[model samples]
Every structure is written in C-alpha cells, then in structure tokens.
Target: MKVLLGISSSIAVFKSIDILRGLLKEGVEVQCVMTKNSAHLISPLTLEIISGKRVIIDLFEKRERSDILHIEITKDADLLLVAPATANIIAKFANGIADDALSTIFLASRSPVLIAPAMHTQMYLHPVTQKNIEKLKSIGVEFIGPYEGELASGERGIGRMAEPEEIVEKAVRMIMKKTLKGKKFLVTAGPTYERIDPVRIITNPSSGKMGYALAEEILRRGGDVILISGPTHLQPPIGADIIMVESTEEMKNEVIKNLEKVDAVIMASAPADFKPKISLSQKAKKESIQYLELERTPDILEEIKERKGKKLVVGFSAETSDVVENAKKKMISKGMDVVVANDVSKKGIGFGSDLNEVIIIDREERILSTGIKRKKEIAKIILDFIEKKLSN
Candidate 1:
C-alpha cells in the first residue's frame, strides 16, 4: 500500500522512524511530510533517507518535477498518517485551519486519514483537546492510540502514541473494515449529574469509555460520528464532534439541538435519578449537615423517545444485579429500539475500565451478548449490530 506520513511537533515524533521501518519491512511505499515545528525535533533528511522518498516540508517547495501542485500530489496516496499528533496540530485539523504543510496535506487528502496523538497528559485530558478529537472523528478520520505510558516530561499517563507496529496493525484493521463507509451516527454516553448546589451534585460512575470506543470503531469503519457525552474523565475519540454537558437537563438540551440529520442516537449517558427540589445559587456547605429536598429529574431517554419521531434510539442499562431482566424492562419503558445491558457488579467489567462485557437487546427481544473484551473490540461488535439493523 502507498502510505503518506504527516509528522507534527511532539517530542514523541522520533518514534515515527520505527513506524517507517515497519512499513518498509511490510513492502509498503512511504512518503513523509513534516510541519516546520516537527523538523526541529526530527530532521527531514533523516526521514527522506529512511523512507527513500524526498520529504515534502513546504506547501510550495517548487514541486520538483510533478505537474500537480503539492496538495494535489499528496492527495493521491492510499492513506494519510499523522504520528505523534500534537494538540496544536489536532486543533488545526478539527477547525479546518490549514496553516501548515502537514495541516494542508491532511485537509488536502482524499484518501483515508489516521492520527496518533501524543502530548502532555494534562493537555490531552483537557476538554478542548478532547473536543477537537471528537470533531475530527465526526469527519471520518481514524486514530490509533494515545496509550498510557511515561511521557518525555517524566510524568506517566495517557498521550503516548501507540508503538509503531501496533499503529500498523490498527491501520490494517481499518483498511479491512470498509463496510460502512460514509455512514453517520449520533452517539451519547456517560453519566449526567444533577446539581443541588454550585459544587454539590449527584452522578453515576458511567465512564463513557464504551461510547468513545464505539465512536472510534465507527470512524475505523469510515463513518461519521456525532458524540454527545455527559460529564466524564475520558476523552472522546480523536475524530468525533463532542457535545459536553454536566447535568441531564443540559444533555437533553444538547441532544435535542443536534438530533436532526442523524442516522441513530445511542442514549448511553446515565442521567441523574433526581435533582434538588431547590437548586442553590451558591455552593451549599455541608458543615451544617442539613436535610436536602429532592425532586426527580426529567428522563432524558424517555423525552428523547417522545420527540425522536423517526431517529433510531438506543439506550444503556447498567445494573448491579439482574442485568438482562432489568435491561428488557428498560427497553420497553424507555422506548428504545435497542438496549445495551451490562452487569456492573462483575469484577473489571464496568465503569472506568478498558474492557467491557455486554448484552444487546433489541425491541424485538433478540439478545446478543459479547464476552469480555477491549472497549474498542466491543464497539466494533456494537457497530456491526447497528450496521446490520440499519441495512434491514
């Protein structure tokens, strides 16, 4: 396969050489491009020597002998890859701001695009960075990993780009899953809080990992995603449009705002059971330990069902016990076309973990369960179900 690699400014960029080595070993042709900032960390000539292709460092470098312009030439490759994708570079791609050579190649590419994000853990975890990733996923881009490991700053956390071989494996898997190209999805995930005071709130442990994984899986299948998520510590997939919210009410508002023009809505966020009867204007001090009045919050999924009209609605039910039975009931009660049920009581299978085991029940009562697996693998299973149902 003909591959085009885009390197951005990140300390982890030296890893790209290993990726180039791996790709060449597999007999794939490699072309390299580097942003001006990335060149400071890794030499352009080094890339050219390793890949046997002259590196393209500028958008208007005189085009050498190609009749086509730089952008046009870069567009002809099978895939465009960005290793060690910095937050700044991601923001550019997310906002359609092509100020640099690598950004131009990304925007110019017609082929499939893959990104491997790397940065400071705190920066990667910031909401804005997560939103940029979400927006890119919503546009049909793919990503490998910003796995958890020690960063150059001597702090250990997420934001390490996946190992070069693992990146190629993901790319190969992506190339294999061209089944749902150009499809669009509306996905929701995480726990919605209900605030009683500026600082006090009620929420579940729903981590939104499954939902984010599903979004990535959808992108890998060459699909667009609109991911609406509630309060969670997790980052949205690197190429989705993320709508963030704190309370179920806010989540409902955002969902209603974006509900149109979507193929399906996956109601995965576990909205609050009840809200304060009187929400305080300021943070309530618990030093006094006073009794608090409470009122039920609006059922987001049910409201969604009432207003859905025609969009497919899927719900998630995390039960401490009696998973299937409760999920079946929730399917009927929430007016969901499909209900994804998981047993949270099981060790390592729920909330905050990288793996999940789930049973999907449709309105027709067809139950499909997957064994324990990585969140991404489980997402693919869910997408397969979604694709099959959509086709029918």
Candidate 2:
C-alpha cells in the first residue's frame, strides 16, 4: 500500500513522526508532503531520512520527472492522509485554495482521503470549520478524531489529534482491497427493548460492540450496509444506512423490508425473547403488579426464511451450554447459511465485552474456532468467510 502523508502547520506536527513510523511498520510506502509553515515545526531532513525519500516542501521544487509533481504523487497513492491537520489547511482544502504543495495534492488526489484534525478547541468548534468538515465528509472523506483532551493551548476540549496507531489503522482499512464491493448487507445489532410502561422496559446487557464492529468491517471492505441497531451508546459506522429499533417486532419489520435489497443478512442482535403479554398503560405501582405475564417475541429468522430466496443468512447463537451443538441446531432449524456460536457464560468475553471467542459453523458442518480474539478481529474472520462463500 502507498500512502501520501500530508502534514500541515500545527503544534501537533511533532506527532507526525510517529504516524510515519507506524505506516512504515505496516509495510506501506509513505511519501511525506508538508505545508511550508509545517517545515519550521518539524525538519524536512528528519522526514527525508526516515521515509528514505526526499520530502516535498515546495510546490515548485525541481524533480527529475516530466509529469507535474503534485499530480504525479497522487496518481499511484492508495490513500491521502493528513495527520495533525490545521484549521488553515482544512479550510484551504475545503475552498480550493491550493497555493502550497500539500493543498495542491489534496486538490489533485483521486484516492481515499483521511484527515485527522488538530487545532485549538474554539477554532475547531467554529461554524466555518464544522461546515468545511461536513463538506469533506459528504464527498466520502473519512476523519479519525479531534478528540477531547489537553490541547496545545493548555485548555481541555476537543481538537487533539488521534493517536498515531489509530490513524494508521484507519488508513489501512481505507486501503484494504474492496473484496465486498458492489455487495449490500443487512446487519442487526444490540439488544432490543420490550416496553412494559412509559418508564420501564425489559432488555439485555448486550453492548452492541460485536455488531458495530461487523458493520465497520463490512464498510471497510466496501460493502453497502443497512445497520438495524437497537439502543446503544456506540456511534453508527460512517456510510451505513442506520435504522434504530426498540422492540423485536420493529427490528423484524425493518430487516424484512430491506431483505430483498441485501446480498446477505448478518443477525448479530440479541432481541428480547419475551415481552409482557399485556403491558400497563401507565407505570404500575410495586403492589399493583404481583406477577408479569410474558409471551414469545416475533422470530425474525423464521419469518424471513421463505422470503429470503437464497440470500445468505448468518445467525448468532449466544449460549450458556452446548455452544456448538445449539448453534448447529439453530442453523439447521432456521435455514441459516452459517452460525456463530459464543458462550456468554464465559468470563471476560461475550455480552458487554470487546473480546470474544466464537465457534463458527456452516451448513456443511465446517467448524472454525477463534480462540479469544478482539471483536473486531472476529468480525473480519466472519466477513472473510462470507466473502469466500459468496465468490463460490
């Protein structure tokens, strides 16, 4: 992978060295480009020595190539990354102000663009800056973070550059081969809530991390995603068509509604198995309700079985015992193409955890066990399996 790293004037320019090193560690060829003002903060010589290529500082710098320098740099780049991007550079890129080498490259680059903004909190929050960021986003430019933390001004607020590791990871995702390109997927996430009253409801402890990770991986692989998510604090992945639902019925309806448009269905949500048979119109007093009647919620998988028409259906089985056995049974009973079974009973994984260990079983009884891996890693494995199956 080749990444064109653009560095603009900012006090956070020092962090760009780490970003360069990280990308190099990933075996990515990085060509460094710096705004004129940034050269004062970090030496071009230092970047040249590390990247083993002369850094481009001047727009008119003489080169051996007959082609335009800025245009040539972007032609073979897989991604254009700006770490510690100053507000000035951002505005320049947003408004077609390309008087400098870095900004000129931004105008000429046709590859995926990833920006990590770093500026004063107040300047970053200004309406003009926000509008510029939105304009870039609307055109599919990705942003990592201007997270809340100690800033260059010594005031705590947003505008801190994301860690170098995070930026490199995002860049890698952007440059990954689009194996899932031109495919549409429906992914269900989180735990559904069954309302008992205006003030109370029944739900599970699922944090939705697994499902959200899956959606992100799918998007990274260039798939169009319809994410039917239950209530969770996690932000929806950029580029996904997000649908929020509270009850099992709502989730089912939305899934079925969009089922025909998707090439696959990844049912990652943990919907409430039962709901109050007769919910009270108002909040019931402690003494007013001695017992609560319950009934089974709608079965989304079963309902879609007849309507799916050969669409790949991937189901999840969160079990306490007989994990693989139960998942195999569910896969067969629901006509699922594959089933991911994980023992929620285990500690440090599953439910609200970021890590998971799953046994993936397919219709052919092929089983693969992923021993204790991050949910993000597991999501990639699942997607890789799905991609291979679809290609077959």
Candidate 3:
C-alpha cells in the first residue's frame, strides 16, 4: 500500500516519525510531505532517511520529472493522511487554499483522507476550527482523534494527537481490501454464567480476547458485526452492534434471535455446560450446601443446526486431549463448516491469555494449525480463510 504522509506545524509533529515507521513496518510505502512551518519543528532529512523517500517541502522545488509534483504524488496513493494537523492546515484544506505542497496535495488527491488534529484545546474547540473540520468532513474526509489528554502547553484538554499505534491501525483499516463489504457476521465472545443462586454462578476463565479480536478483524475487513458477548472486562470493538448477556440461556436466545440477520455465525463464546437443577431464590447457606444437583444447559449449536441452512457456522472447542480429532468430530456433529480447537491444558496460552495455538478443521476434514501466536494474528488467519470460502 502507498500513503501520502502530510505533516503540519504542531508540537505533536514529533509523533509523525513513529507514524511513518509504523506504516513502514506494515509494508506500506510512504511519501512524506511537510508544510514549511513544520520543518522548523522537525528536520525533513530525518523523515527522508527513515522513509527512504526525499521529503517534499516547497511546491516550486525542482524535481527531475517534469510532471506536476503535487498532482503526480497523489495520483497513485491509496490514502492521504495528515497527522498533527494544525489549525492553519485544517483551515487551508477546508477552504481549498493550496499555498503549500501538502495543502496542494490535499486539494488534488482523490483517495481517502484521514486527518489527526493537534492544537491548543481552545483553538480546537473554537467555532472557526470546528467549522473547518465539519466542512472537510462533509466532503468525505475522516478524522481520527485530538483525544483528551495533556497538551503541549502542559494544560490538559481534548487536543492531544492520538498515539502512533492507533493512527497506524486506522490507516491500515482504511487501505485494506474491503472483501467482506456488504456482509454481516454474528460473533459471540466471553464466558456465559449458569446461575447457582442470585449471588453465585458457574463460569469459565475466558477473557474474550479471541472473540473480540475476531470482531475487530471482521470490522476492519468491512463486515458489519453483531457481537453477542458474555460478561468480560474488555472493551467492545468500535462499530460493532453489541448485545450483553449473562446466562447460557440468554446468550442462546440472543444468538437465535439475530441468527437470520447475519451471513455467518462464529460461536466463540464458552457458555456453561451445566446449571444447578434448582436455583435458589436466595443465596444458599454454605453450611446447608451439600451434593448440589446439576442439569445440562441448552446446546446452542444443536438448536441452531437446522436453522443455519446455507449460512456458514464456525465453532470453537477447548480440549485437553485429542484436540484435532475432537474438533473434527464436533464439526461433523454440529453441522459446523469450520471448527477451531485448542489445548487449554498448556501454560501461557488460551483462557485468559492473549495468545493461542489452535488446529483449524473444516467439514471436509482438512486441517490447519496456527502455532502459538497473538489472538489478533489468529483472528486475521481465520478471517482470511473465511474470506476465501466466501469468495469461492
């Protein structure tokens, strides 16, 4: 992917270096464009060395090619990003003033534009700046953040530039192939509780990292997500339609209710397998509790089997032994198109851990293994497989 990195004058200008590096780490080709005033804050040569492309400063600077520099630079760019966008640049962009190379590129570029603004809190909140921002947005420009935090002035407010990692993540999402566009997915995450009493319940160690990762990946690929999640301390991915449920029965009901609305169902949640035969209305006395009876919880996969029809169904199995074999069997029995099985018996992976190693089995008995890796990486691989299946 190719990106036009536009930098304007601001104390947050230092962050542009990290942003450029992050994009390069993602295998993105970056061409840096700097406003003249920005050069006073950070040297253009510094960016040039890191990006390996000569920085563009003056619009009238001599170039080996005779082509219009501003227009030519933007023609092949997949995206145009302005980080540490100062009030001057923002106003110039909104009013179509192209006195400098960066503003000129903004006026000439047809690609998706993302701006991260940085300025004094009062300057950002000022009606004039806000009007300019809105004007840009009305014409299809997108903004990341001027998040609330300590500003360059040491006064805390809402004009701090978003962190480098966040800016890069948003840029990647904007440039990635929208293969899942117009598609919707239903993803369940976390662990469901089975009531033992109003004060007690049975649950698992699931942190919902895997499920949340999958939801984010789906969203990044342009798929609409209905995230049915059990109790977890994790934040929901942005842009997901979230439904919070507590018990296995509630999770099952929500899944079934939203089933028909999605093209695929990913059963990533670990719902309780059993529940108390008779849940007490009040908290059970510790002394009186002895040999409590249990009953099987509703089998969500089984209940949805016949209703799934042509929609793709994916299930997860957490096993201690015969992981692949058990997953294959479960895939067949539950009418699932794919099954992801992992061994939770090992240390430092699965459950509450951010990492996982899994064997992916298909209904056809084909198997693929992902050696222990971050849940986010695994999420991408799963979605890549799903995208391939969808395309075929």
Candidate 4:
C-alpha cells in the first residue's frame, strides 16, 4: 500500500510523526507533504528521516528527478491522508485553493482522501469551518476526529487530534474498497460475567479483541455495525454503535432486541455456560460457603437460530477438544451459516491473547483454516467469507 501523508500547521502536527511510523509498520510506502507553516512547528527533516522520502515543502522546490512534485507524489498512491489538518488547510481544500504543496496534492490526487482535523475548539466549532467541513463531505472527502481532550492551550474541548493509531486505522479503511455497504451487522464480544455472589462472578478469558476486530473490519467495509459487548477495558471502535452488557442474560436480551434490524450476526462473545442456581444476596461468609448449585445459562445462539428468519448467523466455538468436529456439529445443530472454531488450549493464541487460529466450517461442509495470525488479520478473512455468503 502507498499513502500520501499531508501535514498542515497545527500544534498537533507533531503527532503526524507517529502516523508516519505506523504506516511504515503496516508496510505502507509513505510519501509526506508538508505545508510551509508546519515546518515552523516541526522540522521537515524529521519527517523525511521517518518516512525515508523527501518531505515536499515547496510547490516548486528543485527536485533532482521530478518537476511537478505535487502531481508526481500522488502517482500510484492508494490513499491521501491529512493528519492534524488545520483550519487553514481544510478551508483551502474546501474552496479549491492550492497555494502550497499539501493543498496542490489535494487538488491533483485521484486517491481517496481522509482528513483528521485539529484546531482550537472555537475554530473547529465556528460556522465557517463547519460549512467547509460539510462542503468537503459532500464531495466524498472523509474525516476522523478532533477528539475531546486536553489541548496545547491547557483548555479542554473538542479539538484535539485523534491518536495516531486511530488515524492510521481510519486511513487504512479509507484506502480499501467497501464491500459491506448498505449491510447492517450485529457482533457479540468479550466474556459475559455471571454473578455468583454480591462480588464474585464466573467468566472466561475473552479479551473482546476478536469481536472488536470484526466490528472495526465491518466499519472499514462500510457496513453499519452494532457491537454488543461484555465488560472490557478496550475502547469501542469509533464507528460502531456499542451496547455494553454484563451477563449472558443481558447480552442475549440485547441481541434478541436488535436481531431483526441486521442482515448478519457474528456471535463471538463467550457467555458463561452455567451459573450458580441462586446468586447470594450478600458476600458469602467463609463458614457459610459450601457446594454451590449450578444451572445452565440460556443458549443465546440456539435461541437466535430458533427465531431466525433469513438473517445469516455466524458462531464461534472456543474448545479444548474435538475442535473442528464440535464446531461443525454446533453449526449444524444451531442452524448457523458458519462456525469459527479455535483451540483455546493452544499456547500463545486464543483466550486473552492477541492472536488466534481457527477453522471456519459451514453447514455445506466447506471448511477453511486460517493458521495462527493476529486477530485483526483474522477478522478480514472472516469478513471476506461473510461477504461472499451475504452476496449469494
């Protein structure tokens, strides 16, 4: 992947260095373009060293190999990203004013564009800037955040630049072709907690990473996503509609409530299979504690399948034994279109880990094994399968 990264004059421009590094880590060839004013805040040589490409600063700067630098930089580029996009740059792009290297590239590029706006709270909220933003949006230009947080001015409002990681994710998504547009999806993630007492609970080691990755991939594909998740410390993907649930019952309720609105459902949450027959009202006293009776929690996937009417259902089975066989049986029994099975017992993968290896089996006996890989990569593979299923 090749990205044309543009930087403008915002104090937040410093964050673009991280953005450049992140793109490089993703194996993207990055060419950086900086407005003249941005050089005053951060040296262009700094970005040049990080990107390993000459940072374009002047529209007519002498180039040993090229004359039209603005036009040349965007050739074969997959995406054009403006990080720490200041009000000046946004206005210039909106009004078709190409006075500098960055704005000139904006006018000349054919690639999809993403802008991460950063400015004073008042400047961002000003009617003029808002109009410019709307105009840009109308023309197919996408934007991420000027998220709320502490600013250089020591005043907190909604104009701080989004984190570099987020910017890079958005940039990657922007460069991809949307396959799930007009489709709505529901994803259940994390480990549901079943309270055993006032303070104690039963849960699994699910980190919610797989499910959240699914949501992010869905959003990247331009799908509408509802993420119903159990308690986890991870930040919810920005474009997803999040529903937080604590127990299996709550998760089931939310899923059942919104099931009809979505075209497909990805059930990645690990709901407790059993719970204490009777939850203690108060903390269990050491002397009073004895054998606790257990009862099976309601099977959410089974229930959804029972009531399913044309909607595609995708399930996950994290098993220590019978991996593929059990997953196939579950897929058949539960009427799932596909079941992703993983061995949670494996070292370095599954459970609370960042990586997973799974076999995807459908009722048709079609199976595909994705060897151990990062959850994010696994998500794209899953989506690729789901997209084919939905298309048919």
Candidate 5:
C-alpha cells in the first residue's frame, strides 16, 4: 500500500522518520511531505534517504509526475498519516483553509487521513484546538494519541505523539477495516427524560459529551452511525443517523427495534431509571400539595445485550459514590461486555463538561484504565480497546 507520510510543524516531527522506516520495512511504499517549519526540526534529506523518495515541500515543486496523480495522494494511496500534526494545521484542515503545501494536499486528498497532534498541554486543551479536533473527526479524520508523557515544554501532560509502533499498528488496522466497507452502526446517546409536565421533566444533565464523541469516532473509524439521541440542547453529532426522542419509553422502544442489525450497539445514553407515572401535556401549576407516582423504564441496554448474538454491547455507568462498586453492579446487571465508570462529582470534569475521568470495568470486574482526559481522547481509548477485543 502507498502511504503519504505528512509531517506538521512540531518538535515531535523527528518521530515521523521511525514511522516511515517501519512502514517501509513492511514493504509499503512511502512518500514524505513536510510542512515548512517541520523541515527545520527534521531535515528533508533524512526523510528522502529513509523513504527512498524525494521529499515534497512545495506543492508545485518541479518533480516529475507519473500517470498516478501524485497531487491527489489521498486518491492514490491506501492511507495518509500525519504525525506531529500541530494545532494550526488541524484548524486549517477543519475549516477547509488551505494556506500551505501540506494543507493543500490534505484538501485535495480523498484517502483516509490520520492525525497525531503534538503540542503543549495548554495548547492541546485549549477550546479552539479542542473544537478543531472535534470538527476534523466529524469529517472522518482519524487520530492517534497525544499520550500522557513528557513534552517539549519541560512538563508532563497529554500532548505527546503516539509511539511510532502504535501509530503504525492503528493505521494498518484502520485501513484494513475498510473491508467492512458499507457496514453501519446503530448507536444511542445522551440522557433521556420522563416528562411530568411540559415545563418540568425528569432527566439527567448528562451532557451527552461522551456518546457524541463515540458517534464521531465511529464515523472516523469508517462505520455508518445511526445515533438515536434524547432531548438535549446539544447539537446532534454530524455524520450520524440522528433520531431524536424525548422520553425514556421512546428511547427504549427504538433500541429494541434497531437491535437485530448493525455492527455494534454503544448504549451510552443515561435513560432515566424511573419515569413519571403520568406525562402531562400542559405545564403543571405551582401548588402546595406535591406528590407523583413513578415507574421503572424499560432496560434497553440489558435487553439488547441479551438478544445480541454476535454484536458488541458497550454500556456506561456514572456514579457519584463507590464508583467501582456501582460500576461493577451495572456491568453485571446490564450484561455489558464493556462498562465505562466515572465519578461525576469533580468540578470541570465529567457530566455537562468537556472533560471526563473514567475507568473501564470489564465484565470480569477488571479495571481497564483510570484518569482524567478529554471525552474525545477517552472515546478513542474505549473504541480502540473494543476493536482489539473484537479482533481477538
């Protein structure tokens, strides 16, 4: 397979050479492309010698073109991997602003684009950078880790590029999964409501950040997404099959109906445990007397898990106390192969916020991971873990 090894302006650009060497060792052809600043950190001569191809810096460089349109490497190659992708480049690609040679090729390419962003923790966590990363994934851009480790800023945080070996492995797996081409996924997201009146409803302010991130990741990993969402002010994740519902009962029935199909069911929605006995059409008037009946909602996640013959079932449990204990209970009760548990009491993290701290308690009650990170990054970890499990 032909690969476009694009390098962005980051100190970590030096790592791309190892990635190129590994790919070439696998007998894959590689053409190196570096941003103007990247060339200063890592010499173009080193890449040319390593890949056995002249590095392309200027888009219109006087290089001979074969019948293969080298300009549209995205169209000709099996994959395009951009290591040490910087925030500037990520934003340029997100808004379709192509101001440089690297950006131009990205715009012209139709091949799968994989980006590994590297920068300071502050820059990586900045709202603008976060939004750009979100937008890129919305358009089918894959990501490897900006892992938690040392950084050029003389501090340790989450802005390190993924190890070269891991990046290559993920790239290969992603390219191979295109064989499941045209395969689609049916995913549910957000917290559901059980209305008591037009104005007042029983719903969790779950934020729906994680589920939305998962839906976006599904699109990036090359699967069609049918996202059944509950009523939330949050915008529906783009590149998904959006079906909006207002009540737990509505979400429950939808899950049962869509269960027979799809490659996987990521039951990330926090459907209300008990809904109001009566759903009033009009807003309720304030009164001194207040009493209402409640009833259990359908167990959508468990029902689907039981009925799922060969499909994947993933569930989420957000606990305020006894995080591990409650998560384990839910994993068994819900019959979920994988359960994501997190404490939502911490400020600036989990529920209604952009970040989350989570632990993956498998069916065996084994803790998979625990830490605070952006929901998008966490979603990638969970999705990659599940993909590995499915492969085994």
Candidate 6:
C-alpha cells in the first residue's frame, strides 16, 4: 500500500523518520512530505533515504514528470498520514487553508487522512485547537495521538507524539475497512491483587497481555473499548479507556458500572477467587499470624450477567485441568455467550507468556480449538468468533 507521510514543524519532527522506517519495514511504499519549517529541524535527505523516494517539500518545485506532484501523490495514494501534526497545520487543514505543499495535498487527497498531533499541553488543550480537531473529525479526518508525557518544552502533558509503532498500527487500521464501527466493548485484564494486610496481598501471574491484545483488536476494527486493568507493567493500548484497579471488588464495580454502555464484555482478568475475610490495616507479624480466614470475592462475570441484558458476555477460563469441561461449565453458570478456555499448565503458552492456546466454546456445544499462537493472533481468533456470533 502507498502512504503519504506529512511532517510538520515540531521538536517531534525527528521521530517522523522512525515512522517512515516502520512503514517501510511493513512493506508499505512511503512517500515523505514535509512542511518548510520541518526541513530546518531535520534534513529531507534522511527521510528520502529511509523512504527511498524523492521527498516533497516545496509546492512549486519542478518535477521530472509532467503530472502535478501534489495531485499525483494524493490522488492515487492509499493513505495520507501527518506525523507530529502541529496545531498550526491542524488549523490550516481544518479551515481549508491549503497554501503549502502539505496542506494543498491534504486538501486535494481523497484518501483517508490520519494526523498524529504533537504540541504543548496548553496549546493542545486550547479551545481553538480542540474546535479545529472536532471540525476535522466531522469531515472524517482521523487522529492517532498527542499522548500524555514529557514534551520538549520541559513539561509533561498530552502533547507528545504517539510512538512510531502505535502510529503505524493506527495508520494500518485507518486504511482497512472498519468492521466493528459503532460498537463498544468492555474488557478486563491482569491479575487482581487481594490485600491481606498493609503489605501483603494475594494475586495470580497474569500479565494482561491477552486483554490488551483484545482491546487493540477492538480499536483497530473501529470499536470503542473500555479496559479495566489490574496492576500490570504493560503500557495501556492506545485508544482504550483504561481504568486501573487493584482488588476484585474494584474491577467488579467498574465492570458493572460500564457493562450496560458496551455491546460486549470480555472477562480476561484473573481476579483472585478468594480474599482474607478481614483485611488488616496494619502489617501482620509473620511469626504471630495463625491460619487466616478466606472468603469468596465477588464473582464479576456472573454478577455482570444481571446487568448485561441482550449484551454478549465473553469469559476466560485459565485452568490447569479439564480446561474445556470446566470452562464449559463456567460458561453455562456465568451466562457467557462464549467462553475461551486455556490450560495454564501448558508450557510457554499461558500466564505471563506472550503465546497462548485456547478452546472457544459456544452455547450450542460448538467448539473450536487453536494451536499455540501469539496472544495477538489468539485475540483475533476470539474476536472473529464473537463477530460471527454477534452477526447471527
């Protein structure tokens, strides 16, 4: 696929090269275009070398071909992506002011346009810029991020350009037809920690990888996703509404609160089945402690059933024994539309691992088992199954 990458004037202009390289590595034909101001920060030669194509920086620069350069590139390109898209450029595009090569191409291009904004926190939050963004969105212009983090201005805020990998993912998603448009999802991930004392807690080994993968797939397919995540070190997927929680009770409350707003719920978190009946505020002395009382924590999947009318509920069962039989039992008991069961005892394919093997079971006794695969691939398989069921 052909992609036109536009770079604007920002300290983040340097990161645009990484974006170009990532696209090229993905076998995408990248054509680099830069605003005049961007050329001062990074030489166009670098981009030209990375993309292996002539860089377009000037509107009037004569080309060897007879066709107008901007029109030629924009007319046939599959996607037009603006990295480090500054507030100035966003305003220009929003207001239809196409004086420069990039803006002119943006106006002339019929292809899907995606802008990754990078600016100061105040500038990004400014009403004018926000309005311009809304205006552009109204016309179907897509955006990736001006992520929250430290900026070149020696301040931390929501103006950092999205990472190149994430930008590439969003670009690829934009070019593909959206299958889950207008759909909403609720996903829970990670291992919930049940506090026993001030310093002691009980938890599992879940890494939240599968849940995060599921959320990313939902976003890529044009769905809105809310991810309730337990304490995990993984970076939250871009475009997800992330709610951080600790104990099972918190996860349960958040899921219950948002369950009705979503079309489906994917329970991927491994909440501790039991918690200490009494949580002590002070740390207990190890030598003085006797057997602790245990009680079942709230069952999030089953509780959500009451509030999940007409909505699909998908549950995950990580069992060391009788994976399918136990999972099917839980699916029926918890009222899950579908259940994904995996054996954590399997080597290299569960718990904290990046790979997984799963058996997907439905209400009608239909079953589909998968070989060991990356969690991202497994996520897609699960979603494919859910999509078919939803359509039916």
lDDT of 6 by residue, 146-229 (tens): 889999989898989999999998897777558899999999999999998989998989999999999998998888999999
TM-score, model 1 to reference: 0.62
Each prediction's RMSD over C-alphas, in Å, is: 11.1, 6.1, 3.2, 2.5, 13.3, 4.4
lDDT of 4 by residue, 1-392 (tens): 89999999999988999999998987789999889999999999999888888888887766687557777778899999999899999999999998888888999999899999999999999999999999999999999998899988999999999999999988877776788999999999999998888899998888999999999999988999999999998999988999999999999999999998999999999998889989888898877867879899889998898888999999998889989988888888988999999998899998889999999988778889999999988999999998999999
Superposed by TM-score, candidate 6 places the C-alpha of residue 25 at a distance from the truth, in angstroms, of 7.4
User: Worst ten-residue run, lDDT, model 2?
Assistant: 59-68
Error (Å) of candidate 2 at residue 224 is 0.6
Cα TM-score per model = 0.62, 0.74, 0.86, 0.90, 0.58, 0.77
Error of 1 at 108 (Å): 22
Give a tens-digit lDDT track for model 3, residues 1-392.
99999999999999999999999987899999999999999999999999999999998977788999988998899999999899999999999998889998998999999999999999999999999999999999999998999988899999999999889989989998988999999999999988888988889899999999999999989999999999999978878999999989999999999999999999999998999999899988888888779998899999889899889999999999988888888898998999999999999999999999988888767788899999988998888888877777
Whole-model lDDT, candidate 3?
A: 0.93
Ordered from best to worst TM-score, the candidate numbers read: 4, 3, 6, 2, 1, 5
Candidate 5 yields a Cα-based lDDT of: 0.81
Q: Evaluated with lDDT, which candidate comes out highest?
A: 3
lDDT by residue for model 1 over 1-392, one digit each (tens)?
Answer: 77888898899999999988877765678888888999999998899999988888887767547664556666558888888799999999998888767887777778888999999999999999999999999988897789899999998999888888778656654554577676777888888878777887788778888888787777777778888888788756766888888887888888888888687888766778888788888876688547878888777787788788867788888888889999999888888888899998899877888888999999887889999988877887887888888778
Reference-based TM-score, model 2: 0.74
Measured with C-alpha atoms, the lDDT of residue 7 in candidate 1 is: 90
lDDT of 4: 0.91
Error of 4 at 227 (Å): 1.6
Q: Which residue segments of model 1 deviate by more than 4 Å?
A: 1-13, 17-176
**Which residue segments of model 4 deviate by more than 4 Å?**
25-27, 94-96, 110-112, 121-141
Each candidate's number of clashing pairs is 9, 0, 0, 0, 1, 0
Report the candidate with higher lDDT, 2 versus 5.
2
